[model samples]
Target: MESPRGRRQKRRKTFFLPLGTSDGSYKPRQRAGHARSRQTGICQVLKRPESATNTVKTITGRLKNARTNPSPKIECWIPEKNPSNTGLVILPGGGYGGLAEHEGKGYAEYFCRAGIACFVVSYRLGTQGFRHPAMLEDALSAICAVRSAAHDFSVNPGRVGIMGSSAGGHLAAHTLVAWGQYESDVPLRPDFGILCYPVIVSQGPHAHRGSIINLAGNDASPELLEDLSHEKHVTSRTPPCFIWHTWEDSGVPVENSLIFASALKKHGIPFELHIYQKGGHGMGLNAPFNWGAECLRWMSGITGHKTA
Candidate 1:
């Protein structure tokens, strides 16, 4: 992913996070603008998914460090309040190659004001794109990492959740199924999922090619397709979810969330689905949609948090 500054951006030399310090050393994001002083250099370079023994189940996918050296984990946003026994990890959308910063960091800031700690997961983007599983690995590892360090992070690990849009939304869905089905060391599930105009069912132009291609890998095997599709793998206990989409979207079809909602409905799992007449895909939570009131109200109802 090209940095926003690109070459013109003054490159800050690697100095904050030690190259090989084990995980759990970094502190959670604090309210106000204070950032962890230790990891001051490069942002957290994805590392191999850490092994977990009996962590709670939450969100799916896995993330690994791409670089041989570990960089300091960067806190893109500051929390205005403390963790409210519940926290959220955000995976912003970017078609598996790059992350939409506006979607990721800007969205996480909402959790802060609402008194929920948020970890904006910057998973490894595909350089020309990595395998489908690579993004998944990073996503899952991030959730587990937060869960694994719940106490240190100032909240209850049991109530962690994940949210995202577009490609990220799809990963949030895929991760739950992966945890229940895979043998990965990281915990494979999320307690709750909030998908904003997710790209769940991929069969149209709005269908995320990067998502499909990444999940399928180069050969494009049938088994891989089956594995990455979250709708097909949904179980009775796939966790509570809150989903929303707009009919106006030309990118990822609304049917993606519709199918996911149908599956959730069939499974009798607790969920809330809000199909808006406006607000196209990837509107960034607080966009100029008239239904902002409805969306926020719905989110508060589902998560039981107040986001003002």
Candidate 2:
């Protein structure tokens, strides 16, 4: 069944946000919000890929099915210093179903201020039905779109990176692992990967089955679960990754990070791994002088970009 909010978010045909002004929230936050909105508006919607997909309509009559909604809109923020340079594409984590405002909007400026253009993706989620590759399709399309328009956006075609947290992290891993699957295809390869408390183990005792279940649905079979588990698909080609996870994560086992890092190292892929002693999960950009500072420094080291 469709909830009200999900229905509203899936309405994609229109350009501008549906009528009525945004209900005011924390004003300082709103000012930050406005800057981010203006930045996203500069982004032009990219073309959908030629991949074939199959799907059915939702109860709300919108295209909630995976294959039907292949294309994702692209929004960018070109840095003043490197106006026409390629940079990171930030895929905000929303458990494979939604994009959170703080991660997708408020957080984009951090990248824009840095010297890279930010591609905040508005991908279709599983509100309609569980589907494999729906998220991947959207992500791959974003990568290709950015790379194709690298000159127009001032993006460094060869230096583009992709980062995400949690479910978004899982998608990033999958995109990396499946990089070579499409032969004779445009280079959808991301130069590097950043996974924060990523859920890579999808099955087994240490697996994060909820993420897979939520993505594949209640009737998800074991075979489907195994297929999506990034650990199962790791190969030598998986991009160098920088990742971190809290030891106290209750949602996903810390093993998810360990196993992924292990796979990355085993495959000879360059990677940096960190396990914070404290801090619970979903601490989105929550740095209180202790954990956040270290995390920022780690990101700077890996991406070669300075941090605050």
Candidate 3:
């Protein structure tokens, strides 16, 4: 099958709304605000859907990213169809300094075409003065909002999963391992995790230095680095995972994914892992070497979907 970008079809209208505020009665409003960044950017709220559709539609909106004013927001991408009742929330990779825009929606639309609901999340970047807990908080809020608003998005809350690449993968892994430990009235853990060429460690040459520096700060303590070193923290509580990476990826190193997979095995958490010989790093939803089909196939076993 051709990728969404390769196929020609009539584009459908998309919507953007604040996650908690939309209740099927939302009306589109023209408001100027930043788009998930401390830097000023205009983002408009879209009208809520009266009901779900079979075509491609989206709901993009802001979710709280920080505790203070002038903070960033999380952008949630709601797919048009939910026949599978499965939702996947995505976090794009940018080494904690920025977000990979194509990695966000490109993968979301790919899954949306497979009858799965997807939300592309944009968290606060460290370059904007946001730190460890900020990104994790925004990610947790996105998961909570997706679950709380599952009806509005036409997805099964229990089937919700999270996917990420590179640094974003680190955050996704962080959430899966630490969410249960977080004290919140809302459940924040994802049913599963998908990591693509992820940065899984905070120490060693295989780790991405920029990512660790951006997240833990330059003068980070040994305890802090160990805490963020996700491979050491994995346990049985961590959700099942799907991890993939290219063997020649010198930027982040394939060992990052290998070590994490090893920990997952140690805890006996069921997982699927893949390593490609080519396609270096940061190949976001590109053809010929993409993992979307395999990922969907793996998720099908977990969600009881007919197609993978």
Top TM-score hit:
3
TM-score of each: 0.71, 0.72, 0.78
lDDT of each: 0.61, 0.61, 0.72
lDDT of 3 by residue, 118-164 (tens): 77777778898877777876777667666655655566667789999
After superposition, the stretches of candidate 2 with alpha carbons farther than 4 Å from their true spots are 1-69, 183-185, 289-308
Candidate 1 residue runs with Cα over 4 Å from true position: 1-80, 182-188, 202-206, 290-308
Residues forming the 10-long window of minimal summed lDDT in candidate 3: 34-43
Candidate 3: global Cα-lDDT?
0.72
Please give the range of 10 consecutive residues that has the lowest summed lDDT in model 2.
52-61
10-43: candidate 2 lDDT, tens digit per residue: 3222221111111111111111111222211123
Q: Write the per-residue lDDT of candidate 1 for residues 185-224, one digit (tens) a residue.
A: 3344677888878877644454577667765555776776
Estimate candidate 2's alpha-carbon lDDT, on a 0 to 1 scale.
Answer: 0.61
1 or 2, which is superior by TM-score?
2
lDDT of 1: 0.61
